[model samples]
Target: MSDQTTNQQQSAAAMNEPLLSVRDLRVAFGTKKEPNEVIHGINFDVFPGETVAIVGESGSGKSTTMHAVINLLPGTGRVTDGSVQWNGRELVGIGRRDMETIRGREIGLVPQDPMSNLNPVWSVGFQVEEAIRANGLAKTKKEAKARAIEVLEQAGLQDAERRMRQYPHQFSGGMKQRALIGIGLSASPQLLIADEPTSALDVTVQRVVLDHLAKLTSELGTAVVFITHDLGLAAERAEKLIVMYKGNIVESGPSKEILQRPQHPYTKRLVAAAPSLASRRIGAEATMPAAPTSTFDVAALAEAEGHGSKPGEPVIEVENLRKVYKLRKGNFGSEDFVAVDGATFTIRKGETLALVGESGSGKSTIAKMVLQLEEPSGGSVRIAGKETAGMSSSELFELRSKLQPVFQDPYGSLDPLRNIGNTIMEPLNIHNVGDRESRKQRVLELLDQVSLPRELATRYPNELSGGQRQRVAVARGLALKPEILVLDEAVSALDVLVQAQILDLLAELQRDLGLTYLFITHDLAVVRLIADRVCVMQQGKIVEQATTEEVFENPQQEYTKNLLAAIPGASIELGIVEAGDHVPHTPVAGSGSAPFAGGGQAGAQA
Candidate 1:
């Protein structure tokens, strides 16, 4: 069908009737006697071929509401009141067998956290094929297998045939996520509920997945309920935006209108905290030469902070870093996979150097090497001008005190069995930093530094929300008072408001204490906000390295340009920058150079 025809069909479908109607939906968990209501009387509609996004922070009952609609709510969660209608059929108290028949056929779900959602025991192909067969999309086993491969490819997984045989544990985070997306899309359901579907993916891959979804929506008239914390993505993709806070729908309207002029205070805060909007606001406030377009001059903000002018002593220096993994083939031969290839970068005190790239681009590998978690095949890593290649176990343990790592998944990184206070004080106890009373005091202080409540010390990881858990992770990282922090995709999974708050906390800590950061992320919008200098990586090599402004404004490499262009909401015109609102220009101490070895200037400093 032509684009115009498809659009006209979509418009007509929207005018006809809503595919899914949720009216005054209420959801509660726990016992029937004393239920804890999470989703409180929320109303929304999903029309055929239209995309609606539910944007909110974690635990805002967005997921709960969706789960309630499909009868997939976890544990004791039940629809306490209200109604859910699918094609005029009431689904409030539908039988389990009937709901199962309608689930994958009429309403598909792509859940968040691919790791838990995917079956670890089964091959990726088997899972996809199972979904296809269960949905009655294919009859014969052969047909189901063929359909599964096609679905996987459509979901952006390259080498779908080979990947189908592989287990979930063998795939990277992004690959696993793609597999889940394939399963969700296998049946070509009427309505797809995508819950943070691209959180694990890089910008380019995210674009491809979303594009595929758009194409599916247009071609097949699939209505999408995209649940996400990314306001920018919500604005770019969804036609309607539903802002949820706590349990209520705070605002609902056109996506662009909500982003441009948010009515609710929570929505306003979300819009203001969005990285893309914040980057533009910072650029407007800074005094710098404008780019060819209206791109934010992040380099100018770094310059305003005295980046590249006054060089601080290099705290961490990596030269010719290389990591190779041997892939066993048939238990007889092995193939070498070069993860990091001669990557070199220098991070000075009080500076933030961002390593930006797609998944499998060696960013995390480099971070692991720097943290001494993985032994490098070849390279020199120096800390405080001292070589660390031949460090003893004792020496490495001592070095860990000065160098700490904050990983992407806060829940995975933290110990669920331990309370927040003990988790924070673990390093202190291991290193014997202070006595019991002193260590307890230090934990309280660290909690305050991370802007978390002191009373939360007794709470466990599962008890806290995603943002609070991340703050606890930060506090634990700071327990040793590390000089350098290696944050790998730290804020990629967080909501805009929480991400902004975490960035602010890191900046404040950097200013208060002269700490350095190695920020590894696939998010270029966030790179613009937090990075002084950015090193763009591709195929295990640094393709471009420069100050944040230079890279964003005048990207030399095509890959870098593609990464920047792939950013969601970059095309959206947010004309809400206040004239007097400016990012405070404070002089942060630091400067360093990472000589780009390919396609760009050597010794690029910020």
Candidate 2:
């Protein structure tokens, strides 16, 4: 039998009584002048109480499929073919009002970026309560507030009652995501669709969120359609996996089977590209390729280019850094929050030290303290062997040349009003490094250094892709010719291919520049790639510290072990297990949500 035919048969077998069934779904955009069809013929199913992950790279139609299923496709796009059915009801023919009824109450959706998904003007509570009020779940304001608080607590958000009164801007990125998740799941929807739910989150934070989701789904028996580009995430969290490439399901099977013995080339590439998998450091053949890198290596490149020798002293050192924030009183009581509790670390010349932890682990707080963006309650920050804690504003301004930062979101970091050329020139202008012509030349040189085209100089932030925006950010960081760069989740938003490219660029940059890097990120895969040393942080404390190889291969702390163990496919050993009562597989049946191959089992063995 042909592989395509067998794949179809297997797909059919997997979907017995699915909560949602998508058949031959197709979407297209543009006009007769320049038409583009995004999604071709595609099919999938979400079973009751089962979490099915749609794994694919960017622009692979995973988001488009979700938008189509929820009847929320943008005005520019249209569903050209196929049917989306929910609980045996045809969604394609449903009216706008009818579709709205099912959108939040029957099928909930959490978007890719929380900043875009939330309303900045409204209080978070009011926005969340609106869902309940709109759905007629709560008639009174009191009931709505009660429901909102309950939902927020369910989402693991602390100070739920007070947080509801605050605008989205008041919340941090991770907190905002948690609040948004509460809003999406508040209506008790039977099916939830999450798009890249924890993309840029720290591993420990990601675990908490994923654990919450797993608990909620299990308790409510709600079906989930989780969309992500991270293969490791899919392997750990998903019960069923559907691998998509160019809008086609090239592979679908049990999560373990798919990870252990991927039948598709795309899936194979995904596994190979994963940072967690490359962390397997032992028994590599002599001919094996070295692991992929993380972010741009500006420091290394500068050194090789003979751009001056390493400084005779440490670049930055923190001695008991502390940042305490006071939480304003709301509907609830007031209290002080200690974001960074006497945190200390050191970055040497021409080295990369990664800060690893989950969300709310105080990594960002520590970074801010070092950058002097936030005033530390107590402790000292010394840069280049000079004390920074008591430096005057003028002195701090002078220190800008020695310390620079690359923020997590390039879009937010760069001014939308300014073009790429002007953005990169800002640092040079701020420091009064050179005249107009010199700054322009420096901008072009930095752009070339980061592998960006000089022609992009005129393009605004909106005109550039995510990867291009990031490259621009890199160029800006290098504009000051700093000795140390603080990279805060710099490459977290990019795709595997783009990330690999950026990592290579960062490595090259580091080699030539001889600059130190304080790399902060939650992704262990990325940690494995670029970091020479690793520091595991929990609750604003360094739980474990070791060389990169030692930390990845022989982690000592339980937090570190649990974080490592939580990585998907970490436990798989390239073998298949026989189906048993404990390892259940759905038996195929005719006319179910999944295409049923006659007399066949629903799952594939590795």
Candidate 3:
């Protein structure tokens, strides 16, 4: 009875007051003489036990606004105006010492980029332990280490104990992100600020993370402010939604209202362009029509033409492709880790063959082998009918012009020092394809082809948004007019609208240039749309391979079916969560504590 009263008192106190209150918040960057303002006068109040989401495009100032709240703005940035109040106490201009105390204790932050936040030298476990100790959660190092494992386990890391010992360099992008999540929740603050925290995670992991948050919200009343470009996900997870555009809050209202009847033009465009909201896949008209076409319709007939002769021609073939890495297992008996195991698949000319799997599933390993970037331990990769295993240096150099790659991280793939125009022209220069003048002209033409503004030629890559940078990457990939393009998780990190645009652009290019694509991704929805065929991979092997229709309509394997069922917003179309829907869960070893949210109290309300 006493425990229940204490819980009631805590919940009542939290619900009675606004956890965070922001009004007319204005932030600025650049020199004093040349000032530039971002995040202009945004207002939002986050109460206890509620999840609020801020949705916008990359460089739309959504992230900047959040950074301003925590006073962690990058170079030359400062809060020029407005107020940020936590529990009626002014946070802006507060001394760093006091702010530090409040940061992890009252508000926990999960940064946007995991690679930037996690230290390369420290093990993930050490970082999580540090966060816990700093917050005064655990008394000793041993307790902190045990708590760290529990946190990682809750963040959906299957092998938390083993993974905790590994460093950041050893972990994949998704694994690193999950580790960050575990650290963020180590303190179990009153408020949790997640900025695209699960962007790197696959659909299933993403779902588990969100569901875990929902459970925390219900049990602990942990207010969450989720920042993301995924509008559909925001609508499904958040109660209140705020839309930002080019440094301004465009709209703020209930999530369902904003999604269904958006007041702003930008929000309307987002909803229309979001592929997850749409029932049918795009590009079906271009691929195959339901009925037959008339002979007199020249344009329609031209569109109706499939990869007629090119259907059987294999642009990329992998025969028993395998990649093995030697790993030292503690004392003795070193084990060979098989990254890719007999991953055989083919990409036909003018067709998109998608390799669908979660992180570390060897989809990327297979791509590397096909591109001749990585030497396979056991198999032969034939590119454009030529075996790549025994090709000479010059032969491989020549083969490069026939096959190009656009990697997932556009910023990393591109040189930041070079202007957008030069970045696109670098590939041409390397191949010695054309003269400087002609290359410049080709750059402009490619820019136009990708629908980017010609004015972006002078802009550096760091200045462009994620979508624009990816468009530039695509243009560079097309510079050589390669017969085949290997897109390695290219559009997975982008927003729905940007992803939709990229997909449409790729479709148009394939139609015009007859380009063959070896598309590697974990997104099954994208597979359903852009790919002609799908190959579902599990550990390091292909579990199922079939046409897009066959894979989606009737998935043969249980794993394939689970992948389809894991996508966000699919399970709940109504955009609402009911009571008792999410069962409370905690790590088995640390049963008393919640996995992600500091320590979940034992036998807490579900």
Q: Which 10 successive residues of model 1 have the least lDDT summed?
A: 597-606
Report clashes for each candidate as comma-separated counts.
3, 28, 1
Q: Which lDDT tens digits does candidate 2 get at residues 155-200?
A: 7677788767677766666677787788888888888898877775
- Give the per-residue Cα lDDT of candidate 1 at 181: 91
- Candidate 3 — which pairs collide? 594-600
Off by over 4 Å in 1: 1-15, 120-122, 138-142, 277-311, 328-333, 445-456, 575-606
lDDT leader: 1
Tens-digit per-residue lDDT, 292-355, candidate 3? 1212222321222222336558877888888997654568656677888988887878888999
Model 1: lDDT of residue 592: 24
RMSD of each: 11.0, 12.3, 12.0
- The lDDT for every candidate, in the order shown, is 0.79, 0.73, 0.77
Instruction: Give all TM-scores, in the order shown.
Output: 0.84, 0.78, 0.85
Local error of candidate 1 at 453, Å? 4.6
